[model samples]
Target: MALGSKKLRVYVWFTLPALLLYIGFFFYPALMGLNYSLTNWDGMARTYRYIGLSNYAAIFKDERFLHALGFTFKYTLIVVVAKLAIALGLALLLTSRMRFRSFFRSIYFFPAVLSLITIGLIFNEIFFTILPVIGEALGIEPLSRNILGNKDTALYGILIANIWHGVAVPMVIFMAGLSSVPKDLHEAATIDGAGKRQRFFSITLPFLIPMLNVNLVLLIKGGLTVFDSIVAMTDGGPGTSTESIGFLIYRHGMLENKFGYATAESIFVFAMIAIISYVQMKWLNKQEVGQQ
Candidate 1:
């Protein structure tokens, strides 16, 4: 079934547009950002000065930026862990031999399909109102101040929103993975005097490793790169306690007109994300291979 030379040529021709599109939209912009990172450009100004490493140095020295970087990392970790655990639980629940399984799946996953900004606002009001109502009815109290407007609680609020919104993705993935596992394995485990927990741990859990790895990588990336939701939810506000690198870059590049410094900041973020994701991906991928 080898393709002829003409067919190969046709395939190459078809791929040309996609390749060009990648170069035009992605690679070119990335290279240009890297180039501008080494200079002091006012984005629109004609004259730009090359100041090697200064932008990078400034990022480290800027206390606010450092704080934001730490917060971003913390946010990524919290959101990923919570999402994984909750998603796995919900997935297991939905995958159990229950009636209206599809209904439950939709109930669990509806939030993940939403635009982040919309979800953020909806939850903001929900937590703001419904929590207070239940609290009053039950002799407790909701958060006194605005959740998203308070520095102490804003990041946590954002973290909760992210988890609530993101749980659906991993839940669906886990459900698919669970369904793909052979029922015979569970049945055999059951016959061997294995408890329900034993059968799950010995059989189903092991088989879900690959899907877990994929979902984890996606979760980590989304947590690290989250921007629109943050902006819509808090604007990294109440004194920048929840400010992330994404918001920092936008504020510098778009708001302050410090394009070069922003570019440098972006490149740093890219490096950090790549390094962390690569390490986690390699580790999880190794585990996946072992399971296989």
Candidate 2:
């Protein structure tokens, strides 16, 4: 009993600092934000009154906010699908017996390590300057214009940059998952006359489902809260066509000083992310169980 008590004390002593920091930095701020969301705080005045749900109610009626929300959903769907497909393909290619496999893996993952803002800025120049020059030279009218400046195609520019910056982690994850798949199973499948596609669907894909879930959750969360790339690239410009929920919150809270309204929007975004992630995780977990 004494030994157990001593161990418990040691554990508590080790964990207490981190626990307090978590509560102070994360939990406390989150609760305060929620409290402020119910108020009419403007973030400048010293005194603010609790308005109770007016800010949330205003969200539905705000056309700009609704448009931003819609754009965010569209962006999330496009990025998640494209990122996963590209990452999985790259992972498979890198994992196969090929020349300079390690070199290719590093090349693919290099963009992920680069700063997203920096990449966005670089791509901004590419989209606005280099592409236009090339397009004019090639006599292609579609590419002749500044892509980031065009409302019709602005979101796609951000999507491409995001995919370039985001695919590395998922690729690495898939590589790890692929590495874990038993070699004997694959060899046996080949011996049994299973072709590449057949072996992939029957053997490889089943093993990768967990990693797929992990990547999907990560990509979805990233897509939902995307901000830095858009800020650096377009600043949600081209008539607010690329404004994500995170950017909307930023504009309200930081730019407009409507902290209460921003917080309300944040709460909605949080709820959305939580619900979507839960559904995906639950569905994926069921698939995992079925596979087992």
For this target, which candidate reaches the highest lDDT against the unseen true structure? 2
Q: List the residue pairs that clash in candidate 2.
A: none
Q: What lDDT score belongs to each candidate, Candidate 1 first?
A: 0.85, 0.92
Question: What lDDT tens digits, residue by residue, belong to model 1 across residues 1-292?
Answer: 3568889899999999999999999999999999899999988899999998999999999998898889988998899889999999999998788999888888888897799999888877876777667767777544444567668788888887888888988988998999889898778878888998898787888788889888878987887778977887888887788788899899999999999999999999989878987887787776653544
User: For model 2, what is the alpha-carbon lDDT of residue 276?
Assistant: 95
Instruction: Indicate the TM-score of model 2.
Output: 0.97
lDDT, candidate 1, equals 0.85
Q: Give the range of the ten consecutive residues with the poorest summed lDDT in model 1.
A: 140-149
| Residue-level lDDT for 268 in candidate 1 | 93
Instruction: Tell me the TM-score of model 1.
Output: 0.92
Please provide TM-scores, in order, for all candidate models, with all chains considered together. Answer: 0.92, 0.97
Model 2, runs deviating above 4 Å = 289-292
Q: Per-residue lDDT for 1-292 in model 2, tens only? A: 9999999999999999999999999999999999999998988999899999999999999999989988988999999999999999999999888999888888988998899999999999999899999999999999999989989999999998999899999999999999999899889999999999998888888888899999999999999999999999999988788898899899999989999999999999999989999999888877762555
Backbone clash count for every predicted candidate, in the order shown:
0, 0
Model 1 CA lDDT for position 75: 93
